[model samples]
Target: MEREILLLGNPQLYEISEDVKKEELEDLRPVFEDMFDCIKGIRRDYGFGRAIAAPQIGIKKRLICILTDKPYVIINPTLEFIGDEMMELMDDCMSFPKLLVRVHRYRHCILRYTDENWEKQEMRMDDDMSELIQHEYDHLDGILATMRAIDNKSFVMKKYANPSLSK
Candidate 1:
């Protein structure tokens, strides 16, 4: 089933998500599958979206699925090693439609998560990949890009401060 991604102004995007518990494992798997498919479908059509979270799809769970070289699931991820270096990128969403926004995010980060098979894993991410992880992680924590989204006009003003800016 294709899940509908919640829009930027949706309240769910800003609410902190609850961790997945033991009993909900079975339920979350299919939900994860749906999210995966939804993200893939959107990315395939739009040529955008590296990651997506449950909240973005209106699931309100602490689950996020990212499509990297090896697309994988991250359940109740814990973020660390948030770097001082930042990157601003032009980002659009299935939820946000045609509006592109500039978002500031860490240039490097470390993440710990449970894989689809329930194996615990830790990974270091940098550049756009790091930004993608943080982006979806924000959705897992109920934050939307709009909260940090810069005005299209002001994007240039902030660009000099962060040369890695995008869009």
Candidate 2:
């Protein structure tokens, strides 16, 4: 099933998501399936979504689906390390596709997460992948890119924003 991507005004987007227990992994397979479907649908409609957190679909679980070189599910993810280097980028979210926020993010990070089958895994990511994971991780913590904006001048409507700022 393809779930509806919750919008900015939705209060659920502001609430912290609960961590999914390893035992619940099997039961949440359907939610994972729906997340992937939702992401694909969003990419088809908007042309620019690489990942989505469970909260984006009204699922208050610490889960995220990322579409990178390969699609994969991450459950109970944690940022093990964030590099000192920072980069500023205009970030957009599935929840607020029409708005872009200029935010600072780590240039690299080490993330530890559990796979769909509850196997533990870790990956070091840099550049786009690092930014993407950090964005999704914020959703798990009830933080929006808008909240991380540099300042009042750091936001703009997608159409009015700089073309180079597309992320």
Q: Which candidate number maximizes lDDT?
A: 2
> Model 2: runs farther than 4 Å from truth?
160-167
| Local lDDT at 31 for model 2 | 89
C-alpha TM-score for every candidate? 0.83, 0.92
TM-score of 1: 0.83
- What is the C-alpha local distance difference test score of each model? 0.75, 0.88
- Tens-place lDDT per residue, model 2, 71-109, is 889999999556499999999998988888999999999
- Model 1 residue pairs with clashes: 13-142, 14-142
Roughly what TM-score does model 2 have, to 2 decimal places?
0.92
Total clashing pairs in model 1: 2
Instruction: Report per-prediction Cα RMSD to one decimal.
Output: 6.2, 3.6
